[model samples]
Target: MMDIEKLQLHPAYRVVSDDLRQRIVRGEIQPGEPLPTESDLASRFGVHRSTIREGLRQLEQDGLVRRQGKKLLVAVPRNSDLASAAERALRMHQVTFGDVWQVASALEPLCAELAAQRITEAELAALALNIEQTAAHVAHGRSVVASTIEFQSLVAEATRNQALQLARAPVSLLMRAGYAAIAPALPQSGERLLEAHRHVFEALRQHDVEAAVGWTRKHLLDYRRGCEFAGLDLDLPIPLAMPADGPPK
Candidate 1:
């Protein structure tokens, strides 16, 4: 029996996003379908246009909708850039990078521990592949923060826990933004970051749960130290308008 009270719903938009999301998930809406316009949604929901917009924004942040020029189309799931987009929205609401780090500290190490115990060979290989890709990014002088997130995401998937997956869904937005902010702080972070990941990956490969958890903790703490060293105040609310293009680290 399902727990009715535990059913998820968006707080601000509630039924609107819930119903739409359900349709999308259940295959009623189908992928690549264009969503109705705001006016149409407003009429269907019997709410003001503002309510529809809010719901759309939430969906957009969740990687469920895409904006093509001015048209809002139903997006394919798990957008590569949705994490960045969602983080931007949260910053708009004055959510800070510190808030994100706190959540990462709480959840990610446990994710690593579980992955050590439960990860399959295929998942482990996927993690290794992500690391290899990150190495290429580093070689090209690109910041590997996005690649790092992808690697961590593979860890989460290796856990094979749907609840964990759902729990992580929203927090991923903050992580993407925090990564952008922190990438510039470390000098030649690629080698250091890659080594750290190698340690964590090897631990998982050997099913060393304690080592995986410990390495994950050290990695996250090290990242926090870098942010602090860069004079970014984690305690203060992060401003939304972070400059996207900065001098390469």
Candidate 2:
């Protein structure tokens, strides 16, 4: 008792890509394994070679397949790659600064807690180097926005949680843009940010889960305060570019 009548057919190239995409996701095909040649794929899919090209192009755009020399290999997408796609989608959907802050406020503290328990010595060392560089940048009155983003990214990476890492990537990228706008106007923000990073870094090194969680939460709250002081409206979308009139405030 289905109400379905006539069904629309998908394009042949789309059909071919969907079939191969399933194999990749299901691990019938694995990362670093070369896909069959276009001729072989065309024969298997019963499509023309040009159709195979079109199908493969979809996978390439999705970051599911990559080319090495002349061969296409199944590939793992980088977090940045995934974030760029997600950021584009979110911006198009008019996701506001408040939306990103809510997600970050939750995810970033969780990341700090996990990192406190699981972070490696090498990661701690990297964070120390980052803090040192960030201090130098702040001292010279250089923009600390990039360093702010990198510090958050390092904390997320140290958690050794792939799912959490992916969840925070877009927010981290978004913060870069938002910080650039506000950091210029708020002089003390950079020093305060460095202090927060150091506190969180120390907590992670000590494996103090409570302290790590507390410091990260405080840091995120400070970011919210900075936004308000800079006159940014949290309800407005982080635009794809500076608005024709001016940035949203």
Candidate 3:
């Protein structure tokens, strides 16, 4: 391996980091797999060990790796992991959850309103598929939370703006995770939840933007109320890292 002094000017660190991240995302480096030793990495990148160390540290902070004694291993991807990174990005740029929620809430009603006017037969079929899956989950004594989120994601997709889709990406991801944690505590379930989506779907089918907007707003507000009723701490500095399933305590 090259000595530390020679490593300072090399551009390989970023190359190696990006490649490793791509591999991780592609599952080439599967979760729980051990990474090559620092010495091995140093040789592969033709850099000093210190550069590898720095790159590894960055990956760890991104929730991509963990050190155990002398070994470094990949970590399982978690929604909270993404949420934590998003939180840091938001704070570093002086963003707040309330600010984001306000914007998200505003955008969503409009998305639903537009979707009401623009939904195609294919989109309606997709919504029906999601609703059927959701009902199946409920019948199986499982939370339909993920299917609910998928339904919203489909609605968002119907909006057809790359900027809106990109902006809503992280919010939808993290919110779904948070919702799964508290879904079991909701006062209504089964027919009630099913009926809610069915009504929204029907409104979209009829191209009723006004009804869509009103009902969409009510749906989101109901979710917030459910979070409160379940005693979830939405204001936590870190996104609430909830278990994959069950009501939060």
Per model, state how many residue pairs clash. 0, 0, 0
Give residue 174's error in model 1 in angstroms: 2.3
lDDT of 2 by residue, 9-88 (tens): 99999999999999999999999999999999999988899999999999999899999999999999878889989888
Clashes of 2: 0
**TM-score: which is higher, 1 or 2?**
2
Kindly report which residue pairs in candidate 1 clash with one another.
none
User: Model 2: runs farther than 4 Å from truth?
Assistant: 1-9, 242-249
TM-score of each: 0.67, 0.89, 0.62
**Superior candidate under lDDT, 1 versus 2:** 2
TM-score winner between candidates 1 and 3: 1
Off by over 4 Å in 1: 1-89, 241-249
Rank by lDDT, descending? 2, 1, 3
Between prediction 2 and prediction 3, the one with superior TM-score is 2
Clashes (candidate 3):
0
User: Which order, best to worst by TM-score?
Assistant: 2, 1, 3
lDDT of 3 by residue, 63-99 (tens): 8888889988999645456654764566456443345
